[model samples]
Target: MSNGNETAKGMGRRRGPMGGRGMTPGEKPKDLKGAIGKLASYIRHFKFAIVIVAVFAACSTVFSVIGPKILGKATTALSEGLMAKIRGTGGIDFTYIGKILLFVLGLYLLSALFSFVQGWIMTGVTQKICYQLRKEISEKINRMPMKYFESRTYGEVLSRITNDVDTLGQGLNQSITTIITSVATLIGVFIMMLSISPLMTLIALVILPVSAGLISFVVKKSQKYFKNQQEYLGHINGQVEEIYGGHLVIKAFNREQDTIEEFDATNQKLYESAWKSQFLSGMMQPIMMFVGNLGYAAVALSGGLLAIRGTITIGDIQAFIQYVKSFTQPIQQIAQVINQVQSMAAASERVFEFLNEEEEDQSVENPCDISKVTGAVSFEHVHFGYQPDQTIIHDFSVNVAPGQKIAIVGPTGAGKTTMVKLLMRFYDVNSGAICLDGHDVRSFNRRDLREAFGMVLQDTWLFQGTIMENIRYGRLDATDEEVIAAAKAAHADHFIRTLPGGYQMELNEDASNVSQGQKQLLTIARAILADNKILILDEATSSVDTRTEVAIQKAMDHLMKGRTSFVIAHRLSTIRDADMILVMKDGDIVEQGRHEELLKKQGFYANLYNSQFEETVA
Candidate 1:
């Protein structure tokens, strides 16, 4: 739950309103071309669909662009007929005007139909791409090395799957159609305006640079504010999640006022940046409109002069003005599309980065069969470190015959649990080998190697399911009676039955409804149900009360019979009856012997045991 803050922050960084208009500008891809190239490769299979969408978009824009010119014909006829009637030479042509109006309406309906088809196809393509990316990312997570997860926050990884992929999807859906339609509209509208009057078309062309300059200026001014807003939003999100998760701790320490102050500070910054960005972005439309009006006024003035001189018809002037308005709109749409492309590139890069991370080798060339392994384990000069340059377990060596109860006793940071991890191959040793039944652990497939052993750690893990289901997780094919038998063996059956629904009782996520001791007991039952040839218990009894611990120790002794068991215990009293006690310090075993003999030697183990005895006496 402590990781909730990191997840919130990651989400906030990429969070924005849909359609790419208000996306945060905080992140940009380092290699824009490369990211786009990779994204292009992903959609190459859908190229045919994209081509269809582009054709539809062009058709839609072309029909829309031709509407004004066709409409102008009707206007010309009506005006000429009215003038003729005033001079008593002719009358209005309502029939011709009606035909022109109906034709224009058909064009518009076709345009809308084309637009819908393109939009629908583009949406399907975008969703498919997003789905594929998410699927690959999910598969990648399982194959990724543990070190990668340990080095980064879970939220950061999750954001690549959720936020980054979603941003990429939305950007693709909007940007592709937008770029196609906007460009088509620009070309078609320009051609229409030129046909009406090159002089008015030229006058409209001058407005492009002015409108572009204003848009550029606004984008430049608003970008920094957008970045600040995104940064502060992430900060606020992280702070809120962190404080909420630990509110009880804050309350216990009487730090509510401090938390409030911190939250206020972040909220204030978010408000400041958010308003500034919104204000600047909001100014763009009005600014463009102002520049557009200047162009419109100039065109209208020029068209009227040409009209009076009979250089162009009144209908031409009307159509040219409409074309001029249509022309500036595509330019604005193109500018927004550019922003969307940039955002898309940034998001795709993040998702690709995660997808390309190094994956663990989950298989071997010819895996050894461990099904019949008798668990004769040995570590021969094994060496390892989470980081290669800083070795933790140095020159470790040990051997255990089948069916030995081996207790590992040490202070914290003495590589006790590390030894168990090595045996299980959670991490492979940097040098030498850990072997079972004279075969190196690496010789077997990771799954086969792991299936031979069962583990019960100090931290019990139970998912959101019924108690019966959680216990059944140990051996998925086990029967309900076998599950109950295992639970009885671990002494968990009594408390489980006392619960509201007994075996059917559901545990919430984290299993907070149960006491710490109960959770530990449930895990023990799970391990017992697994009934592997090798068992590793790392402080498995540390959570239980004194009497429960005694009962559990007896259960453990019974379960460990005729199996290779490695027990790591901080409480020296718990492992006194073990067949062998190996005392470790600073990643090396300092001593090893039966408990009584080790105490008689008056060495490190004896001193540790004496300290606990003194504490008990006091």
Candidate 2:
């Protein structure tokens, strides 16, 4: 099968998802041995249990392997006794035949018992490994820098955590036992076949090259498509998630047909890769079986000739036939195990890539404590960029006194929210010092520094929980009464009281049950409850009506007392009473003053302020 990626590339379109960022297939790890070696470290903890499993697997396969040979003895004895009775020499040895039959039954039962125990042990080992992997991924996600998430799609990260890990665990569970059992059976069956007839053994050996060639050819042809299939699968999942999350936008914009076209393109690619992979990989078993039958024909013919020549008995020929059947069975199983291992290796590469991401530096060696911070903040000659080559914030500087309300107004992408991000230390400045109170912010622990500030963004976030619980998330120890007070202060208590279950009403996923404006109010209540010395409000009232905004502004006016607050807003009218206004454009502060002072200047801030009114006039 041809690689779909190469085909797509040949068509001049890059191999990726759809119109948006494509999730092309992950490259195979350059170091397969190293990747597998690291995976083994996770397995090493369960070595003792795995060793026990191996012992049982080996014993089970051995017992099963010996059964056919031992049963051949019974067949030979019965045949000899019958021949003797036919010659009128002696009656068949019925008691001896019964003893051999009972022995064979015992062997089969012992094999079954060992096989069952092996499976049970392996199940426990696989589950523990999966648990460890998931736990590590969860922790890794927390430690990862913001840049990592910004660069990768959320669905891609989630796929690593869920799909890749599951594949590794499930593949190991099935492949490990099959590998041990198949190898042991192959070895034992080979020895038994040799004992039965050397000629038959040689005939069976002829099938090995043919089977190997077929499997190798199919695997080589299909491996690339399998990799493509995995990538497209992730792309499909990512597209579906994006569409689902922004379905309202799609409908509003009449992008339903465009979305379907993009999805169909991705789906078409997925289908091409999937069918080709399945078709080629699936051809293995049937082809192997056909070759095995040819070997079987050859073996039977040789065994019959030997039997007629009195070189091998009919019972021995029968055992050799059974051995031949058992031999080919393990070869097929081994082929399957190899495929599973390759897939596991692919999955492990993704998991290891996540595990190996550069985590945020969280050292607290020279940490400064800000438990009693007074909310004075300063940005000293900050220089930074999201990308190294493209600087966004250039030599920006600002200082705010305690209990001051500063409003940041700017055009979109004019570095408005970026200032808040810098203050919160989400992304550190390339060269500068940000200080809280009198101490450098970097000197303070990230957790402690963030604890001093309360942020309410335009995009409200409420998890699936009761209204009370979502509010309480701000200050976990807050009493129910305290929560109600905070809600009242944010002008949300009246609405909450009217709900069917009041604070107990469950918020569904995405909190779609509540209006966007209501969600913003809850977030404001959360900020109020946090009671931090520093507050950052980013378009906090953008979603609410004029009446609601007035009420929210009144509540916020009370909340802002005795606290240093930074308000980022597009509506300059709301920030009229701010102690100071910093008008920014292209990552620089072009004008700064109180609203009245800036309006008199008639600069960039004036144009920005006047444009809103002009748009309204139009």
Candidate 3:
């Protein structure tokens, strides 16, 4: 089991919802314009749909803006008829007022219909873009080099798929429509206010700078708190996930108190930042409402003076007051949309950065045919390093003929697993060549080259599926009879049958439902079913009891009768019958011979073999 600190280190940084908190300081894009440019290019294919959405949004805002002005005409006519009735000239004109009310209602209904159509189209477009981005990211994963994944955490890669994509989708859907409608409303309302009275229009305009200044002050004050809040939220989530995953290890080590104290520290920081940020964000609405009331007062006072001067009617005053309210709303919406754009740009940058990473060349000009490969392999003066400056395997050379059982014995970090990785072409040698049947391994396509060998590693891997399905993964077309036979040969059939569902037993994620030795047996059975020309077993029997190890050794012998086999083992007793034993130390072969011959030589191999017995006897 891993410790909590190691688990947290492996997880790296976690991210929350971008739309909820807006753009935190650390989450800002390095190059905002560049990221937006790339995003525009990516969505260029959907230009026609976007244009339609824009037209509909504009039409919706225009109709809504006109309704207030048209309804003001009804008010003016009603006011005139009341005065005329008092003078005995005319009563209220109910017929004319009803026509104006119906017309205004129709305009509002049209505005709602346009808003719905635009919303529907924008939603479809956003989903399509998200689908395409996910598809590309999935394909990119297959072509990325092994070193890229080895150097980064799984959570880091998964975030690009889940959190970043979700942010981009939600931001895109909201930002475009909000910008269009807000701008249209601002322009239309300003024109209507000016038509009523330029003096009142000027008064409403003066209050804008004051409202904008206060809003700016609130935003600046809240930004630092929001950044801190988001940062601690990520830390808190990572700590929780790490602690939960390694709970067993924590219990074994009796570190529960220490773990609780650490969590409390992080939780306290989160509480402090969260409440401060929320308090500041919550202040915006009340501030805007207060400023808006002042604007309403000024506009009403000016309109009253203009009515007394006989320059504007009662209906114009009403329409001008409504326009003042409408004007301030769009300004607030525009400010909010600016924050959403910043969040969207940051998410788009992350996604495009991943998509633009260097991809491994999965194809060659002329691939070698692997139809008749006979399992012969060689490493000629192979020199390699995970990093160029730090060479691990130096001047290594080896040769194996067809149908040979080669045992590689070594201590830990003796370049034992590194050799297997080189043979499989997971990483290429720096200064030499690995060959298959006299042809360079690089000459064959990666897929075809991998298909010729079967491997069972020390760590067994099983997905979430039935036992039969997991076994069938080795050879997709194998029949049930063949699978069962392979399991019997691997000594896994007996244990598998004892389970409640037998071969049909469902394994959860990680396959922790089975014992370690049983998991090892299942992997061995999978290798047997593959029936490849070459086999690589890295500590294949390390997890089993001595009796079970002996049984597996016998079965492995039968399986390797006429196939080229490479076995890596720390247990010296298990490989006595190997045709050749190559002892390695510090990335070089130190001794080679049959087991008895090496023991008789009383060299490094002899000392290693004798010490195991000495330790067991003590």
Candidate 4:
């Protein structure tokens, strides 16, 4: 079946558990409670800010309740008493009316002050949580194995760290406070209304449940759209990130039109889904308000009649009308806040999924602390693979003494690099053992074992920094003089000196400011300065020009001395003079000998060498 058919089938299956399978959402979904709990746990880290915001919210609610009650009471004073006529209560009683107005004015001032505090507290909480989650995500990625990265895109990972986390921030901080404050305001208004007239309150609440039920029904339908919107947005973010990073590749392959069409398709779907969700959610407030006001009118009409029949005073009826307005205001607020809850639940699931991933095994429980390592390597029946249950290396064994140079020769996918990866502890062996100086590699600490080798790869990634800083990356504490010396040793200084500011020269994104050859040599300089006892060059010169290859090879000769060096070769020219060469096939060493011995055997290595030697002559 096609991918689209598979995706449709999967989405259909997903709805069964998400309350999307003909299920009513009378309460929060079971999964949602856990998501809410996780968000609350993360939110509790900023308890001081939460407390400050809660206090401000409480002050605002108190002012709201008092301000309304006083205004109503001052209105009733005029109709109920001779004090209403003698003091002409409604018209400026600068002494008494002024006091009432002044008290209301004071409440407004306090409300404004607390509102500003609430805003600041909420902003701080969002920023702090976002910062903490971003930091945790970064650390988590570092711990994950290469397998996780291999199956995922740079774009997808980027979307999770950026877009998804931002969505979570909106939910965790601002959304939590919005829902809490709105609910609190609703409860406060309800109590005030009940105190005024239980009958009138009952009349106002009669249609409220129906309005809530309809608003909830609309939200339930739109929740699926919200999920779709978020999923498609992640896809869109991934696609856009890909296009921007690979603009040159798209332009080179004449794929611009196809790429643009793809982007438009993604963008349009997101636009439509977002529009549908927002439009549906937007309709909720107005419909609920309309129903609430209908109840409000009923309270006013019926209460006014009770006052005329002398069953209740005009003051009590007037107070009841004002209380009805307060009660309805909070219902409108509650309907609006429900969206925040739904959005956070979706984001929390993603964030937690990432955090819960199994990290790479770093279990060297009894780690040997090495003061100095004199590179001695032995592969005793060594076996390895990048994945579980898939053995790449079978009965592979070799011995390299200190100061020996070894070259590994193989085709593209013959596990040459995989062997190198194993040696570096980027992966552990499937079976057998790799040892250094008669100690199992696993017996030593990970950093110490890795620190024994300085490695250079085919593709060099230069961070956003200066020339000196990039070179200093190998040993962060290395001085400027040492950085320049390493650059000189690797033949990188000549080109670097030509650039503006020499050592201080800045590298743009991915070191695009410099040529590939320059970047490679700078990486070599980084490895050289570290001065490790072992060296690994994994097709390091394969991607560079002949001249650059010559530059790196010359540097390799100097560094390889007195160190066990493993160079995985693509060009046969470099391995002819090596002390030993191991020809690999399907993760096994098919042949191993000196260059002359391998050439006379006319085995796999001989054919590869002859083909390359012939190509050189031709």
Give the Cα lDDT of each candidate: 0.81, 0.82, 0.80, 0.75
Cα deviation of 311 in candidate 2 (Å)?
2.3
TM-score leaderboard ranking: 2, 4, 3, 1
Off by over 4 Å in 3: 1-28, 206-244, 255-294
Please give the ranking of all candidate structures by lDDT, highest first, separated by commas: 2, 1, 3, 4
Local error of candidate 1 at residue 560 (angstroms):
3.0
Number of the candidate with higher TM-score, 2 or 4: 2
Q: For model 1, give the 10-residue run with minimal summed lDDT.
A: 14-23
> How do the residues 1-618 of candidate 4 rate in per-residue lDDT, one tens digit apiece?
001111112112221100111122222334667766876887888888888888888777777766776766666655555455567663434466567778888988887788778977898888887888789889887677655655444555666788778887776666656665666677776787777777877898887788778877987877766665666666676677667767787788888998888778777877887888788879878887788789878998988877777776666677667777766776676666667556667666667777778886565787776556677789999877666787878899999888789999988788887776677665778789988887888888766676787777776768788999888888888898999999999888888889999889999976888988888788888888888888887777888889888998887787677778898888988878798999999988999999999989989999999998899899
Candidate 1 error regions (>4 Å): 1-28, 209-291
lDDT of 1 by residue, 114-172 (tens): 99999999999999999999999999986776566555434456667776788789889
Error of 3 at 23 (Å): 16
Best by lDDT: 2
In candidate 1, list every pair of residues with a backbone clash. none
User: How displaced is residue 241 in candidate 2, in Å?
Assistant: 0.5
Backbone clash pairs in model 4 (N, Cα, C under 3 Å; residues 3+ apart or in different chains), count: 0
lDDT of 2: 0.82
Superposed Cα RMSD, model 1: 5.7
Residue 47's lDDT within candidate 3 is 94
103: Cα error in model 2, Å: 2.7
Q: Tell me the spans in candidate 4 whose CA falls farther than 4 Å from its real position.
A: 1-31, 77-95, 264-269, 310-322, 387-390
